[model samples]
Target: MVFLHARGITRTVELPDAEPLHILRGVDLDVEVGDHVSIMGRSGSGKSTLLNILGLLDAPTSGTLEFDGVPLDRMTAGRRDRTRGRNVGFVFQQFNLLPRRTALENVEMPLLYDGGRGFWRRRRLAAEMLERVGLGERMAQMPERLSGGEQQRVAIARALVRSPRLILADEPTGALDVETGATIMTLLDQIATQAGAALITITHDPHVAARAQRVFRLSDGVLHAEEPILEPAA
Candidate 1:
């Protein structure tokens, strides 16, 4: 099933005393359930802007965006917020865990906003998620006490706690060592697959981009699909 559809999506930022900058021009993408996609671009290539639009955090300047066949512009602000909160999960390079919160608490934060069964059983769900991420023993550890990889694992657990249908990972492994980053990517792919969630990763690393089923390169406010590099047979 198609989870997201974007057509002719464009973003423009108007700066003071400067002409409007076009960040995305006529971007078109279709992401289906369980799809693993990667968008690679340099530091100022507007990759993050596209991600923000896809994740429903921002609206496109022009064009249509549909999530689950419903147009984004058709939804009211509250409905959009509720839909985003319930169906989208984000994992960032910085491992955006709350500094003062324990791993468990950080994971439980999302459930707190659910206001349903998830809210009532947030503790158990958070614990299970942390355990699934191989951090059961460190659930009580503070962000400062955990290593970089461990902190990222906590962030991943937190992002997956709700079993969101779509997972957005931005430069997910940028802060980790090569080995740790590889491990994290593998773990992320496995978990997202098991949960039947669409995974979209935005990165500048070719190695990381190659891990996705489909890859695209963003340049000069445009996105172009890249042919996947095949592996040698054993």
Candidate 2:
């Protein structure tokens, strides 16, 4: 049931005239299908670096990374790109929507790389996703016209439009008010659950991190699991 696996993963960046800056050190994680996992860290704690590695956007300097049991290092560059595009979706702190594009068109962007039924029916599929996010009436609106929450919804719809099996959200609620952020997180969880996709959220907010079934904290290049909070029975 492990959809993505990482063990002893390390990332280091060498400076021109100084010692190497270590971002991640021997981090290990296993993400299963339909799992909701969260990683909490301060601004300089390498949360984004870990997320990029988990999403296959960056490779670890050492150790192993696998997706669906296939080793990432074993795949060719082209295959890796295709695998990531087909299976992983990303939501960022900033909505990252194209300012000029309509909400529907933004949602359709990912399908353009599909080169299959999704590509052929991009508009319809995008519309359906937008509707699911409760943005059907505003599908034609540009990013500027949408409020912060609405823009994030468009981003979420765009991320899910291709029906990715895994969703990586980096500070997804960072830019919103508390109420809107809570609403967005609930919507994200519901949609990911409906799609049977694994969710990994990286955030500094404990309230945000608490939404995940499992939580880990990253500090000084190391990741440690926090004890889960058990709810009281009714």
Candidate 3:
């Protein structure tokens, strides 16, 4: 099934007494379940903006974005929030964990937004997720107490705790050493695949982008897919 489809998407921000700044223009893309896509671009090239739109954290200024074929712009605010919380998971370069919260508490954060059976069982679910990321023993440790890789691992666990259908990772390994970064990416890909989630990674690093099955380049607010560097099994 097509997990996400975006067409003619544009994002413009009006500046004070100046022409509107177009962040994304005429972008079109499609993603399927279990697909891994990487988009590479320099800073301020609207890569993050595109990620935001794809993740449903922000709406496009114009054009259509459909998640599971449902128009995002047409959904009510409440419905949009609920759908976003339920289906999208994000891993960031900075880890984005609550500094004061223990690893378990940070991982439990998503469940609060997804109030249902899992939310009621947040502690157990969060622990299981942390364990899945190989952070079971570190569950009680604070973000400051963990190494850079461990912090990112905690962030990954937090992102996956909800078993989101789409995972948006923005420079997920930018903060780690080469070896640690590679290990983290491997762990992320494995867990995401096991969960049957589509993964979209945004980064400026070609090495990082190469890890994905398909790659794209973002320039001048547009996205163009490069030839696949690594083909998946037939």
Candidate 4:
């Protein structure tokens, strides 16, 4: 399935006294179900901008984006919000878990907005997801109580608890040490693959980008595909 499609996606922002800033220009991307793709870029290269647009958190200034073949340009705001909420998941560089909430409670937050299950059912699903991420024993721990990697796992569990068809991760491992980052990435990819969800990662780390099957470089508001660096056979 074509989980996400974008063509001629452009984003422009205007400062009060300046010309419009073109953060993204004519960018096109396609992601299929269970595909792992990564975008690598320098700071201020608009990688995060593109991610926000793709995740439906922000609308493009021009061009079209479609999710599961449904054109975002044609949907009303309410419909778009519901569609985004149900089909898209996001993980950020900083673990975005609520500081006061336990790992399980944080994972359950999405279900509260979804209203797809009863309170007890939501708790069960969140618990199962936390367990899947190897944080089963830490479910009651607060974000501050967990290590950085453990906190990220909690974030991942929260992102996947709803089983979104598309997962957008922006600098997901940026806060971790080299070894921890690799472990987190591996765990993230494994879970996404098991869920059959398309994963799009935006990162400045080439090593992290190399983990994806397809890699692209975002430069000066444009995205260009780079040859994938394949791993040797075992």
Root-mean-square deviation per candidate: 1.7, 2.1, 2.7, 2.0
Against the true structure, what is each candidate's TM-score?
0.97, 0.97, 0.96, 0.96
- The segments of candidate 3 whose C-alpha lies over 4 angstroms from its true place after superposition are 230-234
For residues 78-132, what per-residue lDDT tens digits would candidate 4 score against the true structure?
9888888888889989988899999999999988887555455899999999989
The per-model lDDT (C-alpha) reads 0.93, 0.93, 0.91, 0.89
| Deviation in Å, model 1, residue 233 alpha carbon | 14
By lDDT: ranked, best first: 1, 2, 3, 4
Q: List candidate 4 segments past 4 Å from native.
A: 118-120, 230-234
Candidate no. 1 TM-score: 0.97
**Clashing pairs in model 2?**
none
Candidate rank order under TM-score: 1, 2, 3, 4
The per-residue C-alpha lDDT of model 1 at residue 216 equals: 94
- What's the residue-level lDDT of 85 in candidate 1? 91
Model 3 vs. true fold: TM: 0.96
Candidate 1 runs further than 4 Å off: 230-234
Q: Please list all clashing residue pairs in model 3, or write none if there are none.
A: none
Worst 10 residues of 2 by lDDT: 225-234
